[model samples]
Target: MTGVSFHEFRITDSQRLDFHYEIDSETEKKTGEIHFQSNIPIPFDPDSVALALSTMCGSAYRRVRMDLRVSPRARKVVESFLRCELSAPARGGVTPERRRRGNVLSFSGGFDSLAALRLMPDDTNLVSMDFGGRFSTEKPFFDKFRPTVISTNIVGTDFQRNSWSFMGIGAILTAPIHAAKYMTFGSILEAGVDNLRRLPLTSRGQTFPPFAGAGYRNAPYVAGITEIGTAMILVTYCPEVVNDSLASLALPGEEKLYRKYVLASIAAERAGLTVDLKEPPPPATRRPFGRNFTADFLSLYIRRFGGAQVRDAFLTDVPAEIDALSERLALTFYERINTTIMQKFPVELAGGLYERAAVAGLVPYTEDDWREYMIVRDALAPYHPTVAR
Candidate 1:
């Protein structure tokens, strides 16, 4: 009674269902709805639905003991996540196992996600959540991949915020529908190590445990690559998509910075430098891009190509370096992927997946591929910030 209580979800229509929940002793309950595409009914499993609801809004509660009907496995997953994230002892009870196969990616048609899509199996189901009308423009873009678009207004509510748990909600909710045993996200290296300060990619406090307990393997397909690498891959493989779609999807001030980084990655690769997974030494002082988790990357770039030139090209301040370090200090995209794939997938399957990606040309960097890069760079350069003379 003193914690969050999840009541049954009411099916509003064929494409919509509303979940009602209450805060500690609150008389009036808050309602959240999950809207599928036209004619796709909500999954009938109460346990899965409860897990999805807890993932969407459980953090809004101060105390974390969520009372809901869930299977033992699902309850364990929820309790573990709650304990780790909110430090609350969550309680819940039973649902049948659904046979599942293949993978489902939480696609957003962004640079990082496109990189993930490229690395995933050919049959991996692409699922994107449209936040009301925020992502309406991407619908046509998402169609290129033939993704299942699920529009939901959950993001419009106060509970919506960036969290590891929040990132995979779409894939989790839609995985059962697609019979996908693996839930993949476009989470990149910068997100886990640079932003959250976690390593090994499978650190316990992240989204892996709960996803595993729910019988869905958590696969961070792009976890090995940095945002810079993602941009490079996109430019090499799909410059048109990046120019026509992803560029427009970026926030007002971010597009230029992203382009600069993509250009920097291209230059680095041409110079035969690759990303070193060895964590860079912490900055001597906080930098402007520190809050964005890209300060380390900037430092890496500075080291790769003299600080003065990088600063001038990117039109951003660079941090002072204590000493010149080798690119070996950072994790190459390939090494990171090899480590990550084995952990997230069966070892037998991991090798084949890696091979498939390699055959599909999802390697470290597009070293020799400058034709598309040059076109993309020139086309987007006008928008990039010009360095003061």
Candidate 2:
């Protein structure tokens, strides 16, 4: 891989942010531009610009030397990842600036996002990225408010979506970091259940959350911990922006009945929004993951292998963590998660962190673990499987 040179970036008159760059080779010379379009002009933030470019570049290049400004942390993270993961080197020269304002909600006008929108202050900057190129002005999700909607047809590229995990990360990175105080992603507690329930039936072990990055609350974007590694990198490098998820904040319990009924009751009573099955589509996506599971494989792997730094990087202080409902719900979730894995996967293939790590010599465990594992694996299954679609 050759070094990627980023030429001057400019917001075109057509509201497109363009990065002009070239790759020189013995066989031929290659030139290209990475474009992000917004109906509104995107204010330039060097750190944001660098972060977006690096994210789009992925781990393919040997060296990424860009002229744009970057935060020290952003520069450090990119250099660290390239060196450690890709064995590549990265260098940049740039200064930081306070170029953004107010919380920018990745509003999709769905149950989770709408619920989130209701919770935010009226003045919060609501932004919807048309990553899928499905942006329609007539869509119901946009009818409620006039927001700064940024739409793009970039998802069809290998650099963007070839790897399933990178999709969400790409969508998040497209955000106008220059104008955001905090960046909020729309994820729900059901997302956690979906991931845990859909734990891969293979030897891959616990995986990162399939839909959202390891369904953690207010998790800072650390390179290896979260599922969508880029988001963690963005938030980590740009301290000016906070990574938040209202769904993670509001729906801590993993109970389906409670989340669907009880939590709805709570949100409706508290937020004054309608909570029911027959509702309009959310501004983001109406139908989220129906059958896929999100896992915290990286975090669990670190807990076993990377020691305290990695563990602490992914951990957070969950406010009140759980309640009576959540406590019972959690117990039920644990018992059911094990049983579900067993039923859907071979018993030999169903174990999570403990069993998988023990077999691989990554962690130490004994026969005592089997009894506890069986309790969840063989116990009478509790929660009934719901129709995710």
Candidate 3:
């Protein structure tokens, strides 16, 4: 049943990040360095939070060496910005900020998240989200966190597709169904935009406005006192290999491969930007290439493409010499896919089987329905990465 363990993991994405850690002195705060070289061009201020994520995601980084510094200004800004809450309480209620910071690396309670947790600083508040569909994979991980796992929920509340009919979003290969990060229009979108506005962009300067009316559309979701209760955070997702905490379930390698090279890869890069990014090839045209491709294809087609763009307080760029530091910033997803699957796809049960395909290179370059993606894509422009926007 098992050769190597498939540990599932969860990654809370942020178009930008501002890690407001406690600092000892002045010089310590200003001097921070990310030693990763990557093909992707990174652009942001050194004191910005996106640095933490940039160093890990695309850049194949091993160690994040930084001289811990505290920016009273940046800290106050990020804390006040991200420290808001989202909860449902009626009338007078005593709701306290969740105490344990479940800074789980890979949410499987097995490998990645656990690694992050092991190294997490004391007093860090642990916050967890519950994907109604991903209970099993998510629950075990919570159990691992024991009492520290603070819970929340997410659902695909709505959607709208773009052009597959004419030359709208997709090409001739366009189908009625497609999933790109920008394909959906509600729930996740509303929640995400609200979260972004509450955060600070500069050194406590700009209010970080929504571009293209993003804030206006999702304003309803952030109404009232629910805004003052809980804050959804972006935790660091480090790569770890925990053999003991792996699930037996996994799609085959060949099936996964097809989804990867063809379906997923195209969808993520191509479909997101170009709509209807799939090739002219039919589903039955090829044998399941590998678990990677089949798994990715099935998941993408299933949701039709929601939950692909799970970016809320996403970190933008922080001036990284990525092109030259290619090796430093270059991440090796060669094994992360299998590891995530083995771990049961933490965030969404569908994630293990579905969305993880979106993040990993499986869905490399695909398109969205021009009609559908635009409806939400433009609305989400405010929350997108600086580079992406």
- Candidate with maximal TM-score: 1
lDDT (C-alpha) at residue 337 in model 1: 37
Give candidate 3 regions above 4 Å deviation.
Answer: 1-112, 122-125, 148-241, 244-389
TM-scores, in order shown? 0.68, 0.44, 0.23
**Relative to the unseen true structure, what is the C-alpha lDDT of residue 56 in candidate 2, on a scale of 0 to 100?**
54
lDDT of each: 0.52, 0.38, 0.23
Ranking by TM-score: 1, 2, 3
Report per-prediction Cα RMSD to one decimal.
10.1, 16.3, 24.3
Q: How many steric overlaps are in each model, in order?
A: 6, 17, 101
Give stretches of model 2 more than 4 Å off.
1-10, 20-33, 58-61, 65-73, 81-101, 132-140, 162-180, 190-291, 294-389
Report the lDDT tens digits of candidate 2 across residue range 1-389: 56557776777774677677676545766676666776566564454455555555666566666776555556665555445232223335544344544455566543345434443445666666555443332234443456665555546543463233343332334344424444444453324434334345452223223211212112111101112222222222221211122232222232221222222332233334333322211222111222222212222222333333333332333112211222222121221122232232223222332342222122221244334333322221232143121
Q: How far is candidate 1 from the true structure (C-alpha RMSD, Å)?
A: 10.1
Over 272-301, each residue of candidate 1 has an lDDT whose tens digit, in order, gives 555322212222333343333344444454
